[model samples]
Every structure is written in structure tokens, then in C-alpha cells.
Target: MATFQIEGGHQLKGEIRPQGAKNEALQILCAVLMTDEKVYIDNIPNIRDVNKLIEILSNLGVKIQKLGQGSFSFKSDALYLDYLESEKFKEEGSSLRGSIMIVGALLGRFGKGYIPRPGGDKIGRRRLDTHFGGFIKLGAKFRYNKEERFYGVEAPNGLKGVDMLLEEASVTGTANILMAAVLAKGKTSIYNAACEPYIQQLCKMLNSMGAKIKGIGSNLLHIEGVEKLSGCKHTVLPDMIEIGSWIGLAAMTKSELTIKDVSWKDLGIIPETFRKLGITVEKVGDDIHIPEHKSGYEVTSFIDGSIMNISDAPWPGFTPDLLSIILVVATQARGSVLIHQKMFESRLFFVDKLIDMGAKIILCDPHRATVIGHDFESQLKATTMSSPDIRAGISLLIAALSAKGVSTIHNIEQIDRGYEDIDGRLRAIGAKITRFD
Candidate 1:
């Protein structure tokens, strides 16, 4: 395990280029299993989850080559799907939720797939019912062996597309079905699907590879099955979640940080949501500059002309993954704001740690909380803490970095699973942070 030791109250000032989208890269990497042609991917983030996924692919006989920084070429000319029964396969596949998508891609290409129970942040009960439901709708038969904790799926007559509406707008579920549908027979109409930026990027990349997909950015998608797909080069988009993390880090540390090459158009309601917390983000031609001044910061209201309660939804709304960071930033702002994390029940449990650090916050419920900025200047005593999830881990890091004294954060592997060289990036901006093994 690794820990981050931070000397707090240092203003971070510099420009940082955000990494590629982790979610998008994982989906695209799995999509490579659908074809044996060479696929080149650029701007892939160097994170633990991605490396683990690559290892899984290599074990399956997929040849991967690292050409340069953030660039790689992958070819699956001789993939072996039977490796799913190996202990190495189960161990690596169970480490991240994204591994579940491998089932769809493998089944699409090889007509059979097997995987163990996937693992990820224990935020709440993240059900795989939607994913398997979508697979079943595509003419795949699924069976689970609880004693071995493994699930298998087979498509004998090949996947036949059908019209179906997802019970929940699950992101991975939509991606799984879309990948399977791309190589299926007949047209697939997916209504009430998740159309997040990652899904849209997946659709675009598949289209570039000869897949016919309509309604790229909407919930309703029409995928026409293609007989075959060839290799193509695609660059992953900059991570919007990471951009949100940087915004929170800049505001909490009271720093003048400039984020470059950000996809500002993809930031649907992020700027407006941050403005509510009294943070003014300036757009300078593909760059977002956060000035280092904190005198007149106040929470802005909603479009209905009332005090807004920020919450998470499926898409085109504030992301559930970023709500923790937003809550942390609210502690240093000028006014009160309500954070409603409707997607997860235990995400707000970290507010107790913030409360111990002299932050004025009230935990309204498991799903909602009201934070009143105390602006407390006292030194936050050094304490030992464990990370809960990816976003919460980074949120705690931001709080520890902005505190008055040194704080030790344990289980930094959770943070590393997402952010690439986080300490190095923060150090470049004058953040007094160190990592210890």
C-alpha cells in the first residue's frame, strides 16, 4: 500500500494537461477484441486499471505494443477466450468493474465468454442485472455458477438485434449491448440507453471502424450490424471527471491553475455548477484558468431563480462520480450548498472526516448533505485515514493538501487506480505532497 504525506496550505500554480478518459479508454480497449486487425490508440492514461486491463488482454494472446508516451497499438490475431477460467484471469477481472465488458466483446467474436464477479468502488449495490439483461435481449444465453462465482454467456445463432428499453440507464450496460449489437445480425434499436461522453466516443470509434451507428449523442441509438470491422486509429478524449477534479483542487488550495487542452464543449453543466460555489472559471481558447483569489466567492443559484441543490443524474447532468469533489470544494466557499448524491448511498459517509477538519457540514441523509462554509483557519491535525473510493480518495487528498498541517492518507492505490502520477502532477504545481511505500 502507498500513502500520501502532504504539507498543507500551499497554493498550486501552473498548467497541467489532463489525461485521456479512463472510462473511454477501457471500453475502447475491450472493443479491440472484436477484431483481429491492428488498432492504434493514442492519449491512453497510464493508470492502474488500464494497465491491469492490458495485462488481461495480453494473457488472452492479444499483442500490445507501447509505441510512445500515451500511445499504443493492439492486435488480437490469436486470442484465447478459455483463459477466463484461470486464477490470474479471475483475480485481475475481479479488480475493476470495466472487466465485465470483456464478456460482451469476447462473446461477440468467439461466440462464448466467461468472467468472474467484477469488483470496484463499494459505493452501493451496483447491479449487473442491466448488463446481462441487455445481453439476453441480444440472443445470448447466460448462466451463473455461484459456487465458483463465475458467469458464462453463449450466442449460438449469433446475436440477433432487437428493440429494447433498458430498465436503468446503466453506462456499462449500454456499452456492452452496443458492442455486441455492432456485430449482430439485423438492426438494433436501443431506447433509454446511456449516452454519456464515453458512450458517444465508443460509438464514434466503432463507426470509424466500419460500424453503422446512428444517434451518437442521444439516448435512442440505432446500430446496424456489420459483417466485419477493420482496424482504425482513435484518440481518447480528455477526461471530464479529471477536469472536475482539477477544478476542485484549484479552488480548495486557493491556487491559480490553468488546465490546457480541455474539451470545453463536453463540459455540459460543469462550469455552471462550479459557479454556484463562487468559483469563476475563465475560458482562454481551449484552456480553463482558475485565478488565485478568494475574497468575494459566493454560491450562485439555479436557473429557476432559487437556491439550487446540486445532484447527480444519468447524463447531461452533474456526474455522480464527481459529487464528492464538489462537496469538498463547497466547504471552503462563501455560502451554503446542498449536495444530493442520489446514485449512491454511502458516498456521503466521508463528510464525517470533513467535519472533523473544522468544516461546517450537516449530513442530511445517506443521499443528501448541506454544507455551510466555516472558512476555519485552524490547523487540521494529522490523522490516519483510509480511502473509500476513487473520487472520495482524491477528494480527501485535496482536503489534506489544503489543510493547515501534515496529513497522512493511506490506501493511495485507490487514487492511483484512476489518476496517473497524481503526486508528480501536483508537485509540478508546487503542491507539497510526497508518496511513501
Candidate 2:
């Protein structure tokens, strides 16, 4: 197995370009199937999950040509509907959860869709009910093969757009439903939809492809169904999760790092969120400069002096994906904060590893963690550990970078699935992390 041998206590100083958005790439790549014409996509992150999805699309007969680095031209004119029912497709689909979007596209174009039980991070029960439930609400016949663990959706009469109020503001669910509704028979209004940057990007791209979608940043989206969608060129935004990771890494290790070309206007409330933790983030043109902390980096309490609390919610709130990074950053801060991860149930379990590194944290429950900071007085003692999920894996890597002594993190494939060239990028910034067996 591959592992990362990180030598901590070294300060990183340099500018690093954040990768293209991985989450958006997943949705966009799947959206390429919405058209039979040549669809050109630039700024695609060449990571494991996206590569796997590309592999799946190739097996289904999509003609994909590498236009250049981080760019691809896809033509779905030769798409094979029968390939989705094959055993090989099932094996590939089970590797990543984002593969489920393929089903929505297939159902839209061919009146049928098939997928195996999708696989992703083991953070919690990421139920697919929201996705399939929306499909059923759209007049599709749904069936689950319990013995073979397969899901099938068929709209033999063709899909008719209907108003859907999703149970939760699920990101992928909203994307899947929106993709399906783009070519439906009528208008589809989605209430409580996920308005994440990725979702908004997907909507804009869809509209460029001839789909009429309203309400760009709001929770309610109105999609006017079209007979067919055409090809369009789309460039993905910078990875917000990666931007947040760099912010936490800069603070945790007391380094000065500049995240380049982050598309400042799109990063809603992310910069201010870090400033609340006493990290000095300066905006130079369009880049984010995080300078090294020279004094006490304390958590700013609420106006009434209550212990600061950071929690995850839908869009416009702190993302749940970066809560682990926040937890690690808080370990070296000057004050306490309660991290409430309300979205995922088991994401906060990684705090045990942080406590073992000498950070003070309390596992209030599966959803909440109270972290008491030491203001860099107590250093983290590094040891070997395994990465649980993609976000948590990077968070641990950041913690290991700041800990004293040599730390080894196994199962780094989880980290590589999302981050593009992470070790190489860190090395450019003077981070002492190497991938080894």
C-alpha cells in the first residue's frame, strides 16, 4: 500500500494553484452524456474518481478525446444503453458514488437507467433515497434488485417535469434531478435544492447547452424542459474544499501561503469564516494570502462571549466537508470552539486521532466535538494513522504536517481520489511529505 511520510514542523512559503473543482467535474462529466454532439470541457481535475467515471463512460461508448491537459472533448453519439446493464458496468459504478449521475442522464436520453449500489466514503449512511425518490416523483418506474444489489429506473412514457420538494438539500440528488428535468416534457420546479457553487456551475453549464434554468443562487430552481440539449464549452471553478484545506494548513503550520486565482466573487463567506478563527487572510487582486501567525491565534467568541461554535449547513453556511480541518486548526488556536457537524453522523470520529497527537478534544457525540486550543504551546506528536475519508484524510495530513517528528499516513489513495498531485503541490511549498510504500 502507498503511504505519506510527512516530516512536520517545517514552514511552507510559496504560492500554489488550487485544482479544478473535483465535485463539479463529476457532475459536469456526467452531464456530457446529456448531448450527442461534441462537448468540450476544460479545467477537469485528473483525479482517481474522475478518471474512473471517464473509464465508465468509455465503456458505455462515449467518444472521449484528450484535447489537452485538463481538457477533454466528449461525444456521446455512440452511447450504448445496453452497457449500463452489464456486470462490468456494475463493478465500475460501485467504485464511486458520483457514478449514479450517469443513470439520470441515461434515463433522460434513453428512457431507462441502471446502476449498481454506489460506493464512496464511509463517513455515514449516504442514502440514495433522495435521488431515487425524486425520479419516482418524476413519473419513472423504479425497481431495486435486492439479490443482485442493483437499481433501475425506466420512464417508458418519457419523463414529465413535476414540482419536487427534496427531503433534504442533497447536492448530488439535486444535480441528478436537474439533469433529468432539463429534457423533460414540462417545467420542473425544485424546492430546497442545494445551491452550492458546484450546483450553480452545473446550472449555468446546462443553460449554455440550451436548457433554461432560473434561480441561479437561490434554493428554489425552475427548469424549463427542452426537447434536446446541445454541446457547450464549460470551465469549472476552483475547488472550494481545497481552498479551505490550504487555509487550515497555512494556519496549523504557521506558514505564509498564497492560493492563486481562487475566483474571489464565488467564495461566499469562506474567507470571513477563517478570519473568525483569527487567521489573517489578505486578498491580493484575486489571490488569497495567508500569512504566518506571529502571536496568539485565538478563536473569536460570539458577541456575548459564548464559546465559539462552528457548524455545517446547506449552502451559504460553513461546509461540512471542512469541519475536520477546522477541528485540527482549533487544536493550535488560543480559545475553545464547539464543532457541530450536523450533516454527517460519523464524520467527527477522526477526533480520536487528533487527541492521540496531544490535542485537547471532547467527543460530545457522533455529531459534535468541543476542541480546547493551546495556542501552539503544546505541539502535536506524530504517529502512524489511516485516512478514513477524502476530506478527513487531507485534514489529518495537515495535522501531520504541523506535528513534531516524522509521521506516516497509510491509505493515502483516499486522499489522491480528490486532490490532484497533492504531494507534488505540497513539496513546491516546502512541505516535507513524500509518498512511499
Candidate 3:
């Protein structure tokens, strides 16, 4: 295990470029299995989950080459479908939830797929029922063994597309079914689909590869099955989540930082959500500049002409993944704000740590909290703590960096699962952080 030691109260200042989207790069890599020709993908973030998926793909006989920094070219010449049953496959498959995507790609290309139960942040009960339900609608039969914790699927007669309305707006579920539907025999209409930027990017990539897809940014998607697809070059959009993380860092530390290559158009309600907490971000020619300010920023009211209550929802709304960081920033703001994390039950559990550090917060319930900014300037006593999830890990890191004393963060691997060289990048901007085993 690894830990991060931080000597706090340093202003981070520099121009830091955001990495490629981790969520998008994972599915894009899996999409290569849908085609037989070579594909070149640029701006692939070098992170643990991405590297793990690359190894999994290579084991399935996909030829992968590192072209340069955050670039790769992959070709799936001969895919071994049965390799999913190997020990290496099972080990890698159980490591992350993204591995479940291989199920859809394998079944689309080879008519058979197998995967063990996937693992990821223990936020709540993230069901795979939507994914399997979508696969079944595409003419596939599934069998699972609870004792062995493995799932297998086969479609010998080829997939036949049909209309599907997902029970919930699941992002990965939408991507999985969209990839499978592209090669089916007929048109597939998916309603109540997740239309996040990652899903939209996947649709765009598939369209470029000869797949006919409509409704790129809406809740409804219509995919026309294709006989075959060829390789094409595509560049991933900048990671909005990473950009949001940096924004939170800048606000919490009261520092001036400029984030370049930000896809401001794709930000949707992100900038608005942060603006409510009194964080002023300026957009300058595709770049977001966060200027230095005092700690006690004011909270803005809602559009209905009332006090604002921020929450998460599907696309075109605030993302649940960012609410954790938002809460950290809210602690230093001037007014009270309500945070409702409707997607996950346990995400608000970390606020206890923030409260212990002298912030005035009230946990309304498992799904909501009311935070009254304490503006505590007294030195925060450093303590040992373990990271719980990717977003929460980064949130804790931001809190630790802004605290007044030394703090040791354990299980930094959770943080590394998303952010790339976070300590190094933060250190380059005058942050006092060190990583050690």
C-alpha cells in the first residue's frame, strides 16, 4: 500500500493541463474489439484502471502499441474469446467495474463472452441488472454461477436488435448495449439512455467507423446495425471530472490556477454548480482561469429565486461524482447549502471527517446534508486517514492540502485509480505533498 504525506497551507500556482477522460478512454478501448482493423486513439490517460484494461485487452490478443505520451494504437487481429476463462482474465476482470464492458464487446465480435463479478468503489449497491437486461434484449442468453461468481453469455444465431427502455440511466450499461447494438441485425432504439459526454463520444467514434447512430446527445438513441466496421483515428475529449477536481483544489486553497484545454461546452451544469458555492471561474478561449480569492465565498440562490439546493442527476445536470468535492468547497463558503447525493447512499459518510476538522456541517441523512460554512482559520490538526473511493479520496486530499499541519493519507492507490501523478502535478505548483510506500 502507498500513502501521501502532505505539509499543508501552500498555494498551488501553475498551468496544469487536464488529462484525457478516464471514463471515456476505457469504453473507447473496448470499442476497438468491435472492429478487426487497426485504430489509433490519442490522449489516453495513463492511469491504473486504463493500464489494467489494456493488459486485459492484450491478453485477449489485441495488439497494443504506445505511440507517445497519452497516445496508443490498437489492432484486434485474432481475438481469443475463451481467454476470458483464464486465471489472468478473472484476476483482471475482478479488479474494476469497467472490466464488465468486455462482456458486450466480446459477445458482439465473437458471439460469446465471460466475466467474473466486477469490483469497484464500495459506494452502494451498483446493480448489473440493467446491463444484462440490455444484453438479453439484443438476443443473448446468460448463465451465472453464484457459487463461483462468474457470468457467461452466448448468441449463436446472431443478435437481433429491439427497443429497450432502461430501468435507470446507467452510463456503462448504455455504452455496453450501444456497442452491441451497432452490429446487430436490425435497428435498436434505446430510450431513457444515459447521454453523458462519454456515451456521446462513443457514439461519435462508432459513427466514424461506419456505424449509423442518431441522437448523439439526447436521452433517446437509435443505432442502425452494420455488417462491418473499419478502423479510424479519434481523439478523446478533456476530462471534466479532473478539471472539476482542480477547480475544487484552487477554491479550497484560495490559489490562482489556470486549466487549459478544458471542454467548456461539455461542462453542462458543472460550472453553474460550482458557481453557486461562490467560486468564480473565468473562461478564456477554451481555458478556465480560477483567480485567487479569500476563503469565505458566498453561496448563490437557485434559478427559482430561492436558496439553492444542489443535487446530482443524469446528464444535463450536476454529476454525482463531483458532489463530494463540492461539499469540501462549500465548507469554506459564506452561506449554508444543501448537498443531496441521490445516486449513492454512503457518499456523504465522509463529511464526518470534515466536521471533525472544525467545519459546521449537519448530516441530514444518508442522502443529504446541510453545510454551514464555519470559515475556520485555526490550524487543522493532522490525522491519519484512509481513502474510501476515487472522488472522496481526492476530496480528502484537497482538505489535507489546505489544512495547516502535516497529514498522512493512506491507501493512495484509490486516488491513483483516477488521477494521474496527482502529487507530482500538485507539487509542481508549490504544493507540499510527497508519495511513499
Candidate 4:
């Protein structure tokens, strides 16, 4: 296990660039399996989960090459299909939730896919029904090996597209089904699909690879089956979640930081959502400039003078991933705000760590929290803690950075799973953090 030792109450300066989107990279990396031609990808994040998925692909005989920093080339012409049934694959595949996506691409190009029960952050019940259900709707037979806790989907005659309405706009589910539908026999229409930027990027990448897809930024998607797909080069967008984290970090520590090349147009509701807590999110070209909150920030009340409430919704709404960061930032604001995490049940449980650090927070339930800011009247006293998940881990790191003393965080591998070289990046910007392996 790795740990982070951070000295708090220090103002960090200088600019930092957000890494490539982790969620998008997971989906896009799986999509590479849909073609036998060489596919080039740029801006890949050097993270744990993404690297695990890449290793899984390489084990399946995909010819992978490192072109440069954050760039790679992949060719899946000679895949080792038998490897999918191996015990080594089961161990590797089960370790990453993103590995579920490879099943769709495999089923599309090879007619069958099998996987061990995937694992990821234990935030809540993350069901795999959406992914398998979508596959079943598209003419694949589903089977489960309860003894082994494994899942398999197969279509001997290949998948045939059909019109279906998704139960929820699950992002990974939508990506998986969309990848399968691209090589299906007929037109597939998916309604109530996730329209997040990650999904949009995947759709565009598939289109470039000769797959017919429409509805780039909407809930409904239409994909026409093609004989086969060709290779295409793609670049991932900067991670919006990381950008939002930096915004919260700048405010809580009263630091003036410039987040470079943030892709403002794609950051729907993120900037405005931070502004609701009275944090200044300025637009300077493609960058986000967050000035020092020297006097502290105040939470804006509702028009009816009711208490402020912030919640997560589907695309174009506030992202649930950043709600943890928002809750941490609200701890030092001038007023109170309610954070409702509608998507996950257990994300709010990490508030206890903040409570231990002297922040005033009411854990109303598993899904909601009410934060009462300290307004800088009292500083958080740092202490030892353990990271729970990727989002919560980053949230705790932010709280530690703004605290009054040294803090030790265990299980930092959870943090490394998403953020690329986080401690090094923070150190570049004057953050007092050290990593011990």
C-alpha cells in the first residue's frame, strides 16, 4: 500500500493541466477491440485502472505500442480468444470495473464475450444488469456461473440490432451497448441514453472508424450496423472531474490557481455550480482561473430564501463525481448548503472524515449531507485517515491540503486509480505532499 504525507495550511501557486478523461479512456480503450486495423489514441492518462484495462487487452493479443507520452497505438488483428477463459484473465478482469466494456466490443467483432464479476469502488450497488440487459435485447444469450461469479454473453449468428429504451442513462452501459450495436446487423435505436461528454467522444470516435452514428449530444442515439470498422486516431477530452477538483482546492486553501486548457464549452453546469457556492470560476480563453478566496466565500440561497440545495442529475446537470469535492469546499464557505447524491447510496459516508477534521457537516442520510461552513473562523485540524474511493480520496486530499497540520492518508492507490501522477502534479504547483511506497 502507498500513503501520502501532506503538510496543510499552505497556499499553492502556479498552473496545472488536467489529464485525459478517465471515464472516456475506459470506454475508448474497449472500443479499440472493435477493429482489426491499427487504432491510434492520444492523451491517455497514466492511471491504475486504465493501465489495468490496457494490460488486459495486451494479454488478449492486441498489438500495443507506446508512441509517446500519453499516446499509444493498438491493433487487434490476432487476438487470443482462448485467453478470455483463462484463470489469469479472470483475476485481471475482475480487478477492474471498466473491463466490463471489453465484453461489448468482443461480442461485436467476435460473437462471444465472457468475464469474471468486475469490481471497483464500493460506493454503492453498481449493477451490471444494464450492460447485460442491453446485450440480451440485441440478440445475445446471457449466462451466469454462480459458482465462479462469472458472466458471459454470446451470439453465434452475430448480434442483430433492435430498438430499445434504457432503464437508466447509465454511462458505461450506454457505451457498451453502443459499441455492440455498431457491428450489429441492423439499425439500433437507443432512447434515454447517457449524453455525457465521454459518451459523445466515444460516439465521434466510432463514427470516425466508419460506424454510422447520430445524436452526438442527446439522450437518443441511432447506430447503423456496418460490415466492419476501420482504425482511426482519437484524442480524449481533459478530465472535467479533475478540473472541478482543482476549483474546489483553490477556494478551500485561498490559492490563486490557473487550470490550463479546461475545455470550458464542454464543462456544462460545473463552473456555474461552483459559483453557487460563491467561488469565482473565471474563463480565460480555454483555461479556468480561480482567484484566491481571501475573504472566504458564501453559499447563495435560493430565490425564495430557502436553504441552498445542490444535487446530481444526468448529463448537462451537475456531475455526481464532483459532489464530494463540493461538499468538502462547502465546509469553509460563509453559509450552509445541502448536497444530495442521488446516484449513489454510500458516497456521503466519507463526511465522517471531514467531521473528524473539525468541519461542520450533517449526514442527513446515506444520500444527502448538510454542510455548515466555518468561514475560516476555525481551521480544520489534520489527522490520519484512509481513502475510500477515487472521488472521496481526492476530496480528503483537498481537505488535508487546507488543514492546520500534517495529515497522513493511507490507501492512496485508490487516488492513483483515477488521477495521473497526482502527488507529482501537486508538487509542481507548490503543494506540500510526499508519497511513500
Task: Quantify all predictions' global Cα lDDT against the true fold.
Answer: 0.88, 0.92, 0.89, 0.96
Which residue pairs collide in model 3, if any? none
Candidate 4 error regions (>4 Å):
none
Clashes per candidate, residues 3 or more apart or on different chains: 0, 0, 0, 0
Q: Give the TM-score of candidate 1.
A: 0.97
Instruction: Write candidate 1's Cα lDDT for 1-437 as tens digits.
Output: 89999888888899999999999999999999988899999999999998889889999999999999999999998987678888888888888788999888877777778888999888888989988888899999999989878888899879998999999989998998899899999999999999899999999999999999999999999999988888999999999989999998998888899999999988888877888788889999999999975663677777887765889998898889899999988887777889999988988998888887778888988999998875534434455677888999999999998888888899999999899999999999899999999
Q: Across residues 205-262, which tens digit of lDDT does each residue of candidate 2 receive?
A: 9999999999989999998889999999999999989999999999999999999999
Q: What's the lDDT for residue 292 in model 4?
A: 86
Worst 10 residues of 4 by lDDT: 121-130
Error of 3 at 381 (Å): 3.8
> 1 or 3: which has the higher lDDT?
3
RMSD of each: 1.4, 0.9, 1.3, 0.6
Best by lDDT: 4
What ranking of all candidate models by lDDT puts the best one first?
Answer: 4, 2, 3, 1
Candidate 4, after superposition: displacement of residue 182 in Å? 0.4
User: Model 2 Cα RMSD, Å?
Assistant: 0.9
Better candidate number, 3 or 4, judged by TM-score: 4
Query: Which is better, 1 or 4, measured by TM-score?
Result: 4
lDDT of 4 by residue, 240-349 (tens): 99999999999999999999999988999999999999999999999999998899999999999999999999998899999999999999999999999999999899
